[model samples]
Target: MALLHKAHITPTKLELLAAWLPARPWYAGDGPLTRVAAARFDDPAGEVGVETLLVRAGEGPVLHVPVTYRGAPLDGAEEHLIGVTEHSVLGKRWVYDGTADPVYVSTLVEVIRTAGNEAVEEFEVDGGRVSREVDLKLTGSGAEVAPATEITGHRDGDPTVISTATVTLNVNRVPLIVVDPADKGVLSACWTGQETPAVLVHLR
Candidate 1:
């Protein structure tokens, strides 16, 4: 389960992404970005925040960006930092590109191999638990997967690939309108407004 607080955050996520997205070589948007949906993955240690955001800039294709927030800096990952922000409840948060975070990589691989279901998110407000709806639904292939000691992500094309020693994951950075059910060894999701499910990642 993912617990959410009703606290404020300085330099909102969109504000941060707006500044960071343009600098990426794969970004094709020239206008403002609007968030479509978001989902979270639980951190067993409860020390890091793992969330994926779906956003689109103007009329461009929807983009998937996963980010991890930590209380302290990640060692040897200075280049992946998406700048720090002050969390009203958690104090200062050091955000980094999820691809470089071990926690994110491990959780993603586990989800793919186990075909895990999405975790429930609840907002704690006034001592009451309010269930938060997840607009996107994700499912994996449930096949045996090889363990990866080293992982790297490439974002130069439409389908971004994250490669390891044994497996290569093709993540659709820009989601498609219709999903192909014939596609195998993949992770896919569908939003509330979309008619068909979009392929998020495929094992290659």
Candidate 2:
């Protein structure tokens, strides 16, 4: 389960993304970034906050930007760091690129291999938790493979390539709309505005 708090966050997620997206090598869009959909995955240890955002500027292709928020900076991952911001309830959070986060990678692979779905998110309210609806409906493609223990390498590009010992995962930076004959992949997603499923990641 993903627990969220209704509190003020300095430099909101959108602001943070707006500031960071322009710096990416492959990002080429103008105007403000609007979120098409969003989703989250659970961290078993309940420490890191894992989330994925599908956003774009103007009529550009949808960008899949996944990130992890932690209380402290991750050592040896400075290159993947997105930024730091203050969360009223969670204190300071260090955000990193999710493709470089082991927790995110493992959970992503697990969901695909087991044909599982995203974690259920709940908001903290008056010392209790209540279920919250997410925009994206994610579906994993089941495959028989060894567990993905680590992310050996990842190249951020149009089709981001992530490699592990067991398998190499290819993530599309620009998510394509579902055509009649859709391509197969490790994961797929759909939202209210989207008519059909869009392939997210696949084995390379």
Candidate 3:
């Protein structure tokens, strides 16, 4: 289930990026044109492969991020992107959504761990904080993806489990990180893309 198929051809990569980049928080410009380049990254599942994308938009700026996806057109993913073009790879066109993809989440964890100046504990919901982590998980493999991670601690709960990823580098001055329970004070997030979002204990 690698990001690209043998017959998927290189041209399809741009088509997919046109639909994916704008939806991201880092994406800037007013629906600027984009140029896509080849990208690949580490895969934890060894099932659904990962993709590192280099996108240049409207002569404004460029973005690099890893995307992991599966299945057919992702439900509710149409409104978030430019367009999901069909590919001859899996016979049917798959959704190009990256925001909710587990692979992307896992990569975010790694990036934060790499870019931060020091280990910092923080919390964020939409997209804030210099360094933070989550206990959320995403479910559904191959296009039917959804968040599988959730808050595992109760109010005033003991912080035995560190539900945060270490911010490695300061992305746009705002350090990025994850809150997955798999993170053990360090940074860790698992992307199985096998189930839906559910409340799970932080494994740290």
Compose the digit string of candidate 2's lDDT tens values, residues 108-141: 8888888888789899888889999989888886
Candidate 1 local lDDT, 1-204, one digit each (tens) = 999888788888888888888877667765789998888888778888998788999988788888999999999889788888999999999988787787876677777778775679999878889998898787776757775556765443556667777778766777755666666667677787874777777777
Model 3 RMSD vs true structure: 15.6
Worst 10 residues of 3 by lDDT: 167-176
On residues 83-188, what C-alpha lDDT tens digit does candidate 3 reach at each position?
A: 4444465554444434334454444444333431112234343564443332222211111122233322212111212222321111221112334434332322
Who is ahead in lDDT, 2 or 3?
2
> What's the distance in Å from true for residue 141, model 3?
28
Q: Rank the candidates by TM-score, best first.
A: 2, 1, 3
lDDT computed for candidate 3: 0.37
TM-score of predicted structure 3: 0.41
Score every model by TM-score: 0.90, 0.93, 0.41
Instruction: List the candidate 1 regions with Cα displacement exceeding 4 Å.
Output: 147-157
Computed on alpha carbons, the lDDT of every model, listed in order, comes to 0.78, 0.84, 0.37
Error of 2 at 182 (Å): 8.9
Question: What range of 10 consecutive residues in model 1 has the weakest lDDT sum?
Answer: 147-156
Between 1 and 2, whose TM-score is larger? Answer: 2
RMSD of each: 2.0, 1.7, 15.6
Which of candidates 1 and 3 is the stronger one according to TM-score? 1
